[model samples]
Target: MAPAARRTRPSPGPGAVGTGPAGEPVHPAEPVPFAARVVGWVLAVGGGIGALAAFVLTVEKINLIADPGYRPTCSINPILSCGSVMTTPQAEVFGFPNPLLGIAGFSVVTTIGVLVLAGARLPRWVWLGLQAGATFGVVFVHWLVYQSLYRIGALCPYCMVVWVVMIAIFWYVTLHNLHHRHLPVPGAAGRGVDALVRLHTVGLTVWFLVIVGLIGEAFWFYWRTLL
Candidate 1:
């Protein structure tokens, strides 16, 4: 007879891959990528900055209300004067400086961005809240742009920065929300927007270009008036 066969134990079960005796996976959780983490942090920082800027502008508006000559730092040029916009009756819609609304709205956005950056798995409702706030911000920014171009007859540089930041935040948040299906838009409207964002890169580029063109046209008109 051949030598006595030596028996060897078979490998552990399917659950044994990198697992312990409890059959649970023992590998450390994969870390988020540096690029993604950086992007999230940037969003958070941008939101915080936007919120602070809006708050300061609101405070300045308050001071101006107290003293008409209390011009803020934004009173730089005729075309870029917060004083011009603030003194307008439109700024007092609902009997308050509109920047106060921006302050409050951006504060909420900053909070959401911070929580997202911190890797908090926010609930769907929380994402929906952010979407609502961002949507409102987009609407308000457009209203301000309309006021600056048509009503106020002037554009505040600081206000323009705020508008740009608001747009960026809106785009970023909306894109994220769509990717996660957190938007409340339903049926065709929702599907259409999602398809447009997903399928038409050139369309989005053109849309952004159109916004820049409008702003440039306004600047050109103002510059020509100066000449």
Candidate 2:
């Protein structure tokens, strides 16, 4: 006697990671924002790097606490000094070290991304949650950027790594959610949103360029000194 074959639900497509309310993926006129694996890899790699930077920053902070005059290994020079940035009140925005938040947030991001990479069919709400987190991460990173350039007047190398990774993840995740309709598009602005979604890489490139220009302009004196 042969055992009967058991039926199983088919997995979502490689290009689409999440499911709609009816357990189906919405196919808009535009291409999928990105392949599921692409998003997974981005999230995994970005989150992992962000977490590592945050961990290093935390260790530096701890060492600094142990010795008041301790200089972080990342304190390469005057303009790029982690020690200067760590000594500022801005480093403890929530009465604790900022890297603590990074450690917690990015760890979750990495876990979810790995799950998606393993062919997990995340729900629409989960995608929405990622959208929300990415939004917050980008906003916070920008605020830190402003504080670093204008207020703090110094850049942290480890922090810069986090900034770059955070911007990329935010940009891609937002695109994914928008294209999947998890974030939804108003009837009148549907076309506009679609266009924005299609120009994803362009948007990211321009964003990075703007940041570079700002940094150069802000630190022109020290940058020229290096030459």
lDDT of 2 by residue, 36-119 (tens): 777898899999999999999999999999999999999999999999999999999999999999999899889988998988
Residue pairs of candidate 2 with colliding backbone atoms: none
In candidate 1, position 169 carries an lDDT of: 72
Tell me the TM-score of each prediction against the true structure.
Answer: 0.73, 0.83
For residues 75-140, could you state the per-residue lDDT of candidate 1 as single tens digits? 888777888887888777778777777777777777767777787777888767777877887888
**10 residues in a row with least lDDT, candidate 2:** 26-35
Instruction: Report the number of backbone clashes for model 2.
Output: 0
Off by over 4 Å in 2: 1-33
